[model samples]
Target: MNAELEARRVERESSRVISAHARSWQLVSALRVEDFDVAHLGRADQVILDMEDAIDDRLKQQARDHVLEWFAGGGKAWVRVNDVTTPFWSDDLSALAGSPGVLGVMLAKTESAEQVSVTHHRLGGHVPVIPLVESALGIEEATSIARAPGAHRLAFGSGDYRKDTGTANEAVAMAYPRTRLVLASRIGGLTGPIDGPTVGSVHSLLREQSEDAVVLGMTGKLCLDHEQPAVINEEFSPSPADVAWAVDFLEKFEAGGRVIRDGSDKPRLARAELITRRASYFHVDPR
Candidate 1:
């Protein structure tokens, strides 16, 4: 690569590091190789090549080939593989193992810890395995899946989850599952869990749903549209006001010799510290 091209590649590689706490996880279908432009990742902190439900069964092999070819050409992304129950899961693993640019794998419809462990082991136990919990049974078993030996993080598949439970997509209806994932992530020592995607093109609706995820303690969200990442990143990030408050609070706490004056002090200190850390990591400046 030329100097300019090498510099751009380095920048995108840095973005992938931030993706460890990525707010917007954008999904590009493996069937659409034309969309994998690193220059046009928009505000997505991470990109995922989906090889599961998004691709037709008849074209599964074709999609897999496209993903591998992209890897060969120096493209980097996480792969959302087929569920362990499917025959295609093995094929997905076979193609992904030792593949350059395979950042990690997201296991679809994950229902058990064993599935996560197996997938991680299949990839030689080095690649991270993020489990997408979509079914009612999966929700019930979420903590185990989160604590599983090879499990990296958890993501909610809200659309399929609602279908499994016959529930509405409203926040009130989905609150329980969202909270379950959040608590499970904490218990499992993983970063905050990723929430499901909002299913509309309306920016207002997308913002509303992303804010709802924040309120429910989800730190990241799956995004379907390229336009959705900017909005999702904004909502998931600590706002300037939040950073300002945290900075001021920490200064005052330090001035007071870090003494706790009331029951609220400890929680406030924790919150402030968390906000400051996230602001620093996300490159948010206090306004």
Candidate 2:
């Protein structure tokens, strides 16, 4: 009976993934306007509006208005405010949180859970706080940060983190921090501990960076351009080919009570690991 139930569950999940994959492709195909164009105002899955240096009230109001408009039109918007301890932080939070379209604040350079909790309390618990782990200290304290009140997600700031740690090459320098955020988010049951943005123009390089992020268990990425969205989405979304391959791999591996490989025959049985990848397409492609 248990085996029969398990088989049914697998069948249901596979069907769902296939349907979601089709929907994801449809969305990508339907993207008609450039990301910077007004017509494409809210097409992005997630947009980070930064207000780090906006000291003028008028400029801050304009920034808030722009973000609110983006959110109201259908995009998820997060404000990357100035440092929490800075003078600009309070006004930025008040303006953004009061705006109808803003969903949350991306607390830049978060050092502790206490900072997030306090900010949440100030926001009246109406908005989510996504902590940006941008320092060696932040990475070291990631688990607590994930558990902070109103912290729905954690995002790594690769550039800032590298600067803070005085390291180069994310592949080698940020490996431990990336892994730490992923594991911490998993243990804390958060939606994502997002990988940071790629800092290059080469499409292949960005794709490789995204692939490395996936290997490190990040749920999504921070993209600087719309073109990067497709690569990130494709990496996170399970293709029809992937679904078919997984089904075959699982059947063979379980039948033989051993690991099975693809047509290339290279021992690739990791059925459980495919669950999130397969489900990712059901929601917006977070890039």
Candidate 3:
């Protein structure tokens, strides 16, 4: 019975490794684009528009226009709209929903799933909604928020979250929140959560910050500048070494039939962990 069970596990692991390899290849082969060059970035798989303080109708319209152009150029564009509770909520949604280029709307300061649902109803289901959790309340309500209709992804709002929690802008301080968002996103069956941008100066610091976020299970990092998208892409996208290791690990596990030791370690690798590792390769760095 034990041997039979081990065979099943091995089979499952092999299948997982194949899937991971295919996914990794897709991610590495995928195109990437920068922020300001929305038209150029539109060629990539995803684009993010940060509309933090553009409250006026004109600026909002301009933002919507740029996003629409990006979509027209054949890229998936997601706009980070102002907080729903703010005065700009109605205008932002109304403007974006009417734009043909906007594929998704990311709601900032989302405290509950109800907020997402409300926004979806207001937009009349034109685009998917991603909830950005930036406060203690948002973190606590993450699960419900992820389950909300139109909620396709969960994002961490690092700067606002740090200010709200009074936590230092360091990896240790942000770890808990990052993990919580990842857990909630997974439970709610949303796309894996994206880590907040590193509000630092040095390139090395930013790289380290992104690595830390990756360790905490974030699939991607947010960016404010175009240069940042490249930096982010380098970090989130797995290196050639990572691909080699995953491939080798799976090969060894498969050879052993029912039970395999990973690099002499007694325990076998979990299927989920293997998938996560493979998924990491596809995560583009938004430098």
Best by lDDT: 1
Tens-place lDDT per residue, model 2, 29-62, is 1122233222123224455566653336446556
Model 2, residue 49: displacement in angstroms? Answer: 2.1
- Top candidate (TM-score): 1
Write one digit per residue (lDDT tens) for candidate 1, span 184-206.
99999998999999888999999
Candidate 1 accuracy as lDDT: 0.88
Q: Which 10-residue window of candidate 1 scores lowest in summed lDDT?
A: 35-44
After the best TM-score superposition of candidate 3, give how far the Cα of residue 219 lies from its true spot, in angstroms. Answer: 0.8
Model 3 ranges off by over 4 Å: 1-39, 42-45, 54-76, 257-268, 271-287
Clash totals for all candidate models = 0, 0, 9
What lDDT does candidate 3 reach at residue 137? 96
Give lDDT for model 3. 0.65
lDDT winner, 2 or 3: 3
TM-score of 3: 0.73
lDDT for 4 (candidate 1): 76
- lDDT at 202, model 1: 96
lDDT of 3 by residue, 1-287 (tens): 25654465344433331211211101110122233343222222355566654336446556555555655554444577878777777877877666666657778899988899989888887578878899999998998998999887788888889889899988888989999998998899865688776655578987998889878877766665435656766676666665565556566766875447346444335542454464554542222
